[model samples]
Target: MVKWDTLARPKEFGELGFLDTRAMNTVLLAKRTSHIDGCEDSPCIKILEKKKVLERNFFRTSHRGGSQFWQGLQEVKCWYERGRGCTVNCGERVKFRKDVWLGDCALKTSFPYLYQIYRERQCSVADAWERDWSLEFRRNLGQEEMVEWADLSGRLE
Candidate 1:
């Protein structure tokens, strides 16, 4: 008898082209969680609402308590969060350094040294904008650092 692992392999690998059920389940759950924001009519969402699971942010909500399906949904939220990104509008809801608003990655990742010296790491986009983009740092920028700062400044504009 062929082992399940062999049966689950791709046809090109000289085995059956059946999908691994666990991996398929994970992919489906990730897909569901990724689109949960727009699926207001989903029965799973309704169940979460009935169970008071929608009281907090879906990504921030605890996965510790709920039905089997709810637990499964929560388990895939990390994948959802990783793939999701924010687009700044009002700016109040978007985090300046921690969120992926300005570019492909978070500002902290883009400018690690500047982020290290930044005073208000948790400040919102609105807070930084209101400050005229003159964010306070722990110390003055050195000559070499000034060049780096200029790059960051140019990106902001």
Candidate 2:
């Protein structure tokens, strides 16, 4: 019998360029998840709704033990969250610093080192305004950080 791996490789690499069934399945399912935001009536979504598995936020839900199909949906959700993240409209659900609500990139991604070091800055955007940042760090930023912060601040304002 021919090796499956050999057939799965690209034609450019001297192989048959046959599509990987498992990978194709994953891509198709992930594509379907995009329709989750639409009006498409799916049995899988109904099951999740019945189970109360994140009626709003799919990322908040977990895949502990349940349907394998549900698990696959969660995997697609993981891909979505990591890529698109979330936008700050009311600033209620979106997490400040912890989520990518500010701009094109996440605060944590833009300033990975700063995010790890800053303890008081991690909170929901709503809470930050309510508390008025009593414990907000007033420490002077490094020249590079100041540049980065300025760039980020400019976009938000």
Cα TM-score per model: 0.68, 0.66
User: What are the lDDT scores of the predictions, listed in order?
Assistant: 0.79, 0.67
Whose lDDT is greatest here?
Answer: 1
Count of clashing pairs, candidate 1: 0
Q: What is candidate 1's lDDT per residue for 1-157, written digit by digit as tens?
A: 7788989999999888898998888889888786665567788678778878887547557879777778888887766656568868788767788777877878887887778888897698999999889889889977756766898899988
Clashing pairs in 1: none
RMSD of 1: 3.7
lDDT of 1 at 49: 81
* Residue-by-residue lDDT tens digits, candidate 2, 50-151: 887747755466777667877887777666655565646667766677666666767778876455555666477777657653224446567766676666
In candidate 2, clashing pairs total 0
- Weakest 10 consecutive residues, lDDT, candidate 1? 78-87
